[model samples]
Target chain A: MRHLASILLVLLLTIPSSPIFSQGRVLEKKQVALWFGIRDITRDSLANTGDLDFLNYLHSSDDMSEYQYLGVSAHLWFRGNWEADIKVAMYDDFAPNNLNIKAIWLPMKNLGFTAGIYTYPQLMNEFNMFHRLTDVGFFGDTDSNFRQRRVQESGLTAGLMIPFSYRWLHATAYINGGVSTLSPFTEKVTQKMINGNFKREIRYSTSHSPALFFFPEVELGADCFTFGNAMAGIRVRASWYTVNRSVDYGRVTYEWTYANPARNEVDNPAHHFSKFEFDAGFYLTW
Target chain B: MRISTDRTTRITVLISLAFLLKAVSSCIQPVFDFDFDFNKITVTNLDNSDVYVMRNDRDTMYSSAIAFEVTLSDEEFLAAGSLPKAETAFPGFTPATAMSPESLYHPRHHITALRIVTLEEMSPAIPAGSDVTGLFVAYVPRYSEGFLYIITDELLTMINRDFYPGEPSVSFQLFCNQDITASRVLFAITVTLSDESMLTAQTGIVNLLRAR
Candidate 1:
């Protein structure tokens, strides 16, 4: 803890001090910034939900997953201490993870309201982690099958951006509220017969619905350099957002039928999509 | 200059809003509630309960012999027959007049192979108190001219429970690879109870005859 506090203090002081030379230089008023980063996502009490039981089965230390992404934002400085920015980020593993357009009104230099469409998208797949097929030597050539699940999400976000800037050192904290829609969520089961004659497939999904959500973000970073009409910085950011519900239920249907059809529909209730993620990346402004 | 600047700002804001809307719309896709597939097929019940030799039918018979017959053409007599079903359920499954085959050159014990499937149906859908635990198969060739074979251990696999929908409670499958030109074959099954008070033995016959 003491070491952690020392690191925090050093980070706090890393913000550049007021320029020693009393000379002002012109910087780009309208600029585009690109960022490459690594992201770590963690879930809160949400992990207690049984839907995430596979996490424990798969030897995940906890309910956390990591990703990498590229982020692009265009900043336009308006009048006074106000800036309008549009940002879009795509994750390396999945598709576009976040996209939003917001106006930051810094009336008091450090505090501002940031609002726009902030969609959080996530995907997870685990294979054969469940105890479905047990090896019994009775029928040596029988077929064996497995199960897997995938989840997706999107949301609209509005919030406040508070920056603590000291020279080149900069830190921002944000809190937002919005509606999140988790859709196209699917869980699948597939069976492969050893005889190689037949197979079976089934998929389950929750009906998509929009629910209220809370999203908060914190970033700590410092400007790195200015080279040939451009600026660069290293930033570490963490964000958390989730739907308020405990479990989302859905209808499950089977895709196979023999001579006669079997019972097909069942109700599966589980937790909704929610995650807390941390990312560290370099941002280049041009 | 101020008017032009205002106009440019309006255009930029409009374009930004349009882009955001398009991205949001693109992200939206149809949500499927649940879809799944299973590869295994398990039979918990037999489809034809009436066609097989049943445990109850054997118990009621007084004679030590149960008999049924099938007459086949020369081609069928030499070739394998149709798959058998629950015997007790079909009167035709029992001893019936065999019509002589088209080219009846009656070879002694002409049947190259025979498969007997027996089904046991419980009233309350449970095990029997005193059940016929096993089966013994003997083929009497040419109306008792000679006994060809009796298959007990290796050929009898007791199937007690149903595997598919509409199946009986318990079933036994017996496969015999013997030349059964015999007019009849006898099956002797014994039922024993926990009290050890009464032990019942039953017998049945399948008589083979030439089709008319």
Candidate 2:
């Protein structure tokens, strides 16, 4: 805990100080800012109909419900074109938590790109959204300590931010696109079957594939009547994602053995599963 | 000094090219690796009653019956009136002539019926002074020949207790059942115990002819 506090103190002192130092340099284009906000997260699980048929069962058999959370983020900008940001968030249900690091580059005034990696110490809405639409093995309920789905995503995100001002009101409209990969923790399933006088075994393995999606963000706010060098504003944003997923439900067969006869057999082995998600968040910037 | 028309055109083209490049660079597809295997089968028993088997075979369609024996633990044979409402509920036993006798062996039929038994007499081993506190039933389905060679398929059924609009309860059960006999006889007898948690475990099949 003390080490974390020291790290945070260093970041705070350095990030704000860099902008001040740049004020004495030529062009003086550098800027540094930090903002914190709260957000709510919701998720849905992907439906597994084919699994139901093979398993000879129907019903959720587990809890699938909506969840909400509060989160905080810190961002640092430097060299007029590069920025790095980190976020920490937690949910009430299951006490889901997450930490992420992101880097962005703006080569020109109208264009920007970003990449990032993230992990969930607690449940996150983004992870839940992906699992509900793509994961078949996430069928049963799990405890908070169990790391069901922890993913690393690296993609080029580009956006154009258009600024408009009318008297006291200022608005920004942005659009972005990117591709990401979701790597599952468990990658294979093996099944053994017995039929007549033969015993057969089959194994199913899944590989990683890329998913493409688009995001458009718009915000409208106003600078509070100047209070020294400080101002406050609020913004709302939403994103829509489209991705494909494949879940391999293992193979089936009947094989008989002579030495050891196996009478008990598991009938339904595995399922191939895949879904799309739309997410929106609101934040207050100061 | 006025700006030249050629210079304005150059600026417009440069802005357009920058936007185009940004859009192209952002076009990325994420790779998703999913290692989910759905081949596992899970079974569970929710009812408190224990099941017993009188007969089970893959060769004959009329070979099995599920018997529910009620024993009085006290000296008097307690009247059936004192039992729970489930005791008086219609057993819903459709005779073999009505439908396929093999259907009785299906797990769906077993869960739906309160009791399944032939009219055969059963001996109660309780002491004369003991009152009947509980009952055990052994259910056997009459099967047609060549049933054992047939493969049984698993079925997953999701029953939402609160499926109605504005309902509160989100709890539900996934019941997994398989046909023991592949033929029309359906008299194959297998009993497995399970809970409402992770669906795992195997059922034991009893060969009645071998026992006899």
Candidate 3:
């Protein structure tokens, strides 16, 4: 998945650099720029499990609440105030954090409106294994095989971006929405085991649905000249999104006896979430 | 003027091509291939009293004693049996109306009723001209608790002449509530020949696991 996103970013970056877009206007000032930044992200949600103990085990050792990123942007100017721009960014965690390709029209120098495909970051939980607690002290330990469930948001996003400025301070706000597809689908999970020479399969009926989300973000910052035609700035952003109501995609387990059941069936719950994030970052553009 | 027109044409073609590629990729379908060859069936003839469960191989001997160890499900019985919903609701309660016409028309002792098990498959190897009119499944849940599930001649004919090489085996329905959770389920064939000779066969245990 990460590799696919990287390939897309590479394609977007190389397209404008080709002679295909240079048939008319040669090159203009500030048409190309590179940005490097460090960011601190504080994401919180009501439905999300904020339990540090659980998250501690899920995240890798290198994963942090803070990360760094680099980005490349290309702008193609057309009829006067009209422009087409594409920006792609990659984070230190090997995730493609941003990809926005849109047509920008600035009627006035201080304000511009844009619309495009915008990709961002999302968190998910993947269930990797399960075991039944039996009276014989967990029937068939270690030998039992593991089943995996990958949970993610995979889809196309269409939204709008608004950039405005007040004197030396610049602010950009974006609203994006999309529907999920093909990613962590909630479906039945089957676990098979061999007892003696015969094979037995126990299937768990699970359900999961595509996520519908609306993400809105606002960032404020000031740019100070670092070198000729190059500038650096620090910004603070507030971001929030709601992941719509998901279907009942939970796994159920049963307590069994060699004869008849001494007990009953048990149903396991699924995870659903929405989140809010605050990020402070410094970016150098040259 | 010509250069400007050429640039406009190039951009138009590029955008159209991009949309075409997106449409093609979006049509890609997910491939699903699962292994379905798993369950095994073995028959035990009454003639071979020492042999409990014999594999249905090509060289296997034909036996009048047809033993079938079948795992049944509550849903399958409720769906296949001629019993009413209100009657089957009572767990362990055997109903009188469970008999299908196939069982009632038996030439010998007419099978009064059917039980929980539903016959889904049969081996094609039964002797050509034997009277199978009085064959029915005798389902024994446990040592003393049992019931009779009659199998029609039409269903019996589907069985192979003998377990031929690569001969597809038959199967029975499994229910979620009744069969999977039941303490034990037993399925056997009791054949009363036209000459009054009787042969009975039983199957190996069918492992029925609960779904959901």
Candidate 4:
């Protein structure tokens, strides 16, 4: 934790002295902003025939409720249309922590592009693993036990951003899409016997369908106070995103008393999610 | 102007030639000549039982040679008793041993039903006492959907032997009664036992007899 704090302090001190800090014989590209916000995401779209398929086979209903998330981000602006940003956030209940970093390019004053990597936990909550203390019916009553659920790493992201302003208040809207490698949970019961040596394989079949997200943001009441060399304001933002989810399971073997011992291959179902989120937060610029 | 006219004519001729070739290719239908085999049938004992018998009542037991045959028309194959049915009552009874009549009809006795099931359908039903063993045959038709040749209880029996022990094996026979025009046929039998036993070493020969 101390190391993270020191790194943030170093970034704060060095952003102002960079060569891109000057604009038109004055400080133009130099800006350090810190932001904290609360966000809520709700699942929207599922796979084709996913609801009916799950109901007929698994005999369960799909429930989509709004989940709250708290996050912090730091932005550093440099001269010549170059900037860097980092965001870290955590969710409530079974929500996992998400971290993202991006290098942005601003060809013109109003338009920009960002490319980065993102990491977050799996959206599906495991009943046996985490919510064992809670009622089993909360996650759906199934005889199967959940053993493992882990974080998923979204390898890369590339998107475009557009910023608009009205007098002192400014609004920024962005759309980004990229391909990623996904790591699913391992269901190996003997995984511990082998000292957890089991390595989850990354699925590449869904790479053709690049994960896409659109963040159309509006900041209200942006211009207010300029304290010393720092500027602070309060704003409300809403972001909506969509992504294709691919779940892969290896080989399955089952034998019963009345049936034959069968060995077959099971593939992950293709799933898509549409999320709508709103966040209220404060941003500071210097 | 003359050069341009010649170039346009050449392009039109090439396009016409390509269309002619495609039309000719689409008109020709390739004939697929393949053989089906119905020569051998082997029933392996999946459950714990020395002798597997098709029984109707909870108390009475009967055994019969299960029969299966394939024909060209769907009506002939769907006829009742063309498949095997479990005998309901046994006339010659000697305590645990009895023989059923050759010609007897019982309400509860019927041929087992076999249908194609996906993996997801097998998930929940697998843990329960659902029989997953049977014959699987692949049949291909010219314009019709391909169907599997499956015999649920006609040629097999699932013996539950928690009450009896010793030589745990089930026996049944496959009787081919219909004339098959197909050149060759293939049959696959899958068996799952209640206990994990190394019975992979067991082997038996299937006798296929032509109907008189």
Question: Listing candidates in order, what is each one's chain A TM-score?
Answer: 0.61, 0.49, 0.56, 0.63
Clashing pairs in 4: A260-B191, A260-B192, B35-B184, B36-B184, B36-B185, B37-B184, B37-B185, B46-B193, B50-B169
Error of 3 at A243 (Å): 2.6
Residue A15's lDDT in candidate 3: 59
Off by over 4 Å in 3: A1-4, A11-79, A83-98, A107-113, A120-160, A178-188, A191-212, A232-238, A247-272, A277-286, B1-212
* Candidate 2 runs further than 4 Å off: A1-65, A84-88, A93-102, A115-170, A187-209, A249-286, B1-212
lDDT of 3 by residue, A75-167 (tens): 566657776666666666656646656676677665666655555543333322223322122222223344333333444455666777786
Error of 3 at B163 (Å): 20
Using lDDT as the measure, the top candidate is: 1
Tens digits of per-residue lDDT for model 4, A1-286? 2344346445555755566554434344344444444433343334433111110111112434344566656566655677776665556642325656678889998989988866554443432332223322222112255433443545577888777778788877767677665553343211100111111111111122234454444444386788987788776666655665544444332211112423333444545554555666776766
Which candidate has the top score in TM-score?
1
* Complex DockQ, candidate 3: 0.01
| Candidate 1 interface RMSD, angstroms, 1 decimal | 18.8
- Model 1 misplacement above 4 A: A1-28, A44-65, A79-82, A106-108, A127-150, A186-203, A246-249, A252-274, B1-212
lDDT of candidate 1 at residue A260, scale 0 to 100: 28
Model 4 chain A — which ten-residue stretch has the worst lDDT?
Answer: A190-199
Q: After superposition, how far is residue A227 of candidate 2 from its true place, in Å?
A: 3.5
Residue-by-residue lDDT tens digits, candidate 1, B99-120: 4222112122212222333322
